[model samples]
Target: MKNITILLILLTLTFSNVSAQKIKDGETVSLNGLSVTFNITNKESVTVGGKNFDRYKVSANLVNNSEKSFNIRLNASPQVASNTNLVELDCINATGAKLTSKKMELKLKAHNLNATYWYYNKEGKYVSGVLPVIAGYYLDPGDSVNNNAIFIVPQGETPDVLLRKI
Candidate 1:
């Protein structure tokens, strides 16, 4: 009886980890019966305050893969959890030098201006607010949606985006 209980506990944990995955650029991960991915479509600029800032344009996609429909609020501000990171997504160079784990320990710092998928406008074309609004998406079975977000990094470097959660 005791051994069966322990086996069941381990199985539950393994299944949970499988669902909550770390998704990298162009990779799809399953979370709560949904297939989600973040892809950098291109790098573009948004003019703000009479100045122009370059930003990476990312497209987030979510597809309902299960037999039933569901609703999920994207964890846009995952940095607020037990661990704190400087950036929302772990943006690293394509080389992946000094990479230890799939997840990076983000240091508290700043580099340039940017935006989030939260809030924006026609002039600023900004989605940088706090989401309000990670777009508030809910879908039925077999439904899918594509959402856009932007992040700014230093010039001449491309970010290899890695998201631990949705």
Candidate 2:
């Protein structure tokens, strides 16, 4: 009986440690020419560029340890750009989840900008207009290092933006 109890305890501890472990959904190596440290957690149903993403959440923590401000932009394509105004989607900060249908655009008047994405255009183009606002937080300088966004996959559309962090 004593041996069984000990084995059970060890198994419980191992399982607990595994469950308690935090898995990162995504990682940002560099941002805005500054080394950034941040992490995102609890992500699901992630699809980008018409591909079903394996990872649900993106968690990133800066390794370089640089304190700097950078601009982050999220853009989508294959869906023609229109004059239609972009709408803010529902978001939660603690969970780091965002849902938006429209594409996001940014006009950078400054030189300091950091953009990260899963893939880019053939010409290595970056999106400019129709930016999506998630969780009432705009990607800009002096934002939280643990920021996250969600780009909704348009119906019958592939080649979507999966993750973008700066």
Find the 10 residues in a row with the least total lDDT in model 2. 84-93
TM-score of each: 0.40, 0.22
Report the number of the highest-TM-score candidate: 1
> Per-residue CA lDDT of candidate 2, range 1-166, in tens?
9999999999999776432111223333343343333343444455555555333332333332335433333343323323221111221222222444222222222222333445456789764444332211232343333334443333333222322231
Q: In candidate 1, which residue pairs clash?
A: 116-128, 118-131, 119-127, 120-126
- lDDT, candidates in the order shown: 0.52, 0.35
Candidate 1 lowest-lDDT run of ten: 100-109
Q: How many residue pairs clash in each candidate?
A: 4, 25
lDDT of 1 by residue, 1-166 (tens): 9999999999999777533334556887775576676777887654544555456666667677778844443355432333222223455533222222223332222222234455558776655563332322345677776655555544555555655443
